[model samples]
Target: MGTSPDRSFFPGSHWLYFSVYLLAFLVGLPLNLLALVIFVGKLRRRPIAVDVLLLNLTVSDLLLLLFLPFRMVEAASGMRWPLPFILCPISGFLFFTTIYLTSLFLTTVSIERFLSVAYPLWYKTRPRLGQAGLVSVVCWLLASAHCSVVYVMEFSGNSSYSQRTIETCYQEFREDQLAVLLPVRLEMAVVLFVVPLLITSYCYSRLVWILGRGASHRHRKRVAGLVGATLLNFLVCFGPFHMSHVMGYILGESPVWRSLVLLLSTLNSCVDPLVYYFSSSGFQADFHELLRRLRGVTAPSQQEGSMELKVQKEGEGQGQDCTVQTV
Candidate 1:
């Protein structure tokens, strides 16, 4: 198959995109799948929200890896998209769905964290696992529906097939139809990028503020460092991609700029699990404890089974008071 015109549309991107896609998939898939099992199997004692979110994020990243293989193949083969035309739309839809869901879950985690620290009483009153499960289901449904807009618009069309004699699963935006394309692009930017970002930033900022006011220097430093890493990740990995898209919408989409945006966006997927580990105390503990056991640092923590973990600080040297307190 010849490289589609779109392949040549952004020359030199194939090499970079293929490299990034392969790296992300190879790294993210197993990491997330293992995280999924650990969160479900060992970390079950934590809050339902935490577990549910871990599951959701795992699925998101896993789905990205699943969809990426084809993309990697396409890029390696110079964007010829050797897969069947029918597979294109499905692939594109699934790709967008997974990424948006990842964003959604990340934002949700931030909100949950903010409440846990800043509004303890309110956070405690919120539903546990059952509620979190329902919310997670709702998130999946909502994300699926929202991202399916593209599928709905170009679900099946021989015009993209018969006329061009080229099959594409994803519909190209009509470059001339600025009115229609612009609004949809704007909405995608807002829902998938801006809104999630604002929510995450607000929650993390509030969490940092609350933690800063507390007395534990060790805890504060660790949490601060994690939060800083997380925030930096968002700014460095995701911020530029969305900002570039918005800039393109306002200014113009030069090929070089678009390729750069895509590159940054791809980098986000690869870096996200590290972000999760750093942003979350629970994750950091779990991951560190896992590595330590692997390296023979210490024995793994005894398996605490099937009860919620009531988060608390180090013991204050009181006998009966050593029981952990929930927020």
Candidate 2:
């Protein structure tokens, strides 16, 4: 039997990976958390179909960000897995699952928008919230089933090294491992990434075309921004990572630059909030309100002055003078 191939690393790659992972964790964690809070609030007030989809998307991004520290530590340890081997497959599963989950949710969101625009009467008659929930469930099941391959590949019992002796989490594949993994990677590129991309492209194209005919300029502009951000998330953030899968399968081994491309995938968590901002006006309003409150907290005097001015305006309208009374 052929031995496992040695994985090559670019010089200083670990530090670079560690830096990007840390930045993503720090930035994405708060952004997705805020999005989660906002979506939950919006859902409580009104359970809109698009809000439900965005909520699922927010949760998926949070899962990916929460599990990100494993990769961060692995990178910080010079691309070594110092933790228990059991965690390798678990974290790998969550990481890849959430990546494809993002794609699926984005595609579903586009379809929802397209249907609402293209067939409003039909969309109103449907149980949209229930459908969104069902779609979200299917997305989770499908992604989880596909990503379960991580466990099989990791614990295939044919590793050249013992679990304790393994230096990396998911690197250095043997011939048998490659045989199973490469084909699945190719399949994933098609099913999880490519098909979703094509579907998203079609839905958004039709959405834009339909909106152009009668939607107001501001409304159309927002939709345009939504289309641009969603496509950018897919093509810029996810394109290279999935493309690496295709290239790896063709090359019969993982590409040396696959790790670099994955950095872009990590960035999707941060970019998703932009998609949410464009997808729903409620999200934008809540986000701006949060920012406004934050600013008020930061500048107490300005807040007080604004409050006093409001009182003065009300008092003046009532033909009475208002004074600032300090406690």
Any runs in candidate 2 off by more than 4 Å, and if so which?
1-10, 125-127, 158-165, 300-327
Question: How close is each model in CA RMSD to the real structure?
Answer: 14.4, 7.3
Q: Look at candidate 1 and give me any clashing residue pairs.
A: 45-309, 88-169, 89-169
Q: Which segments of candidate 1 are over 4 A away from where they belong?
A: 1-11, 121-127, 156-171, 175-179, 251-256, 292-327
Q: Against the correct fold, how does model 1 do in TM-score? A: 0.76
TM-score of 2: 0.87
The per-residue C-alpha lDDT of model 1 at residue 216 equals 84
lDDT, each prediction:
0.65, 0.86
- What is the model-wide C-alpha lDDT for candidate 2? 0.86
Error of 1 at 90 (Å): 1.6
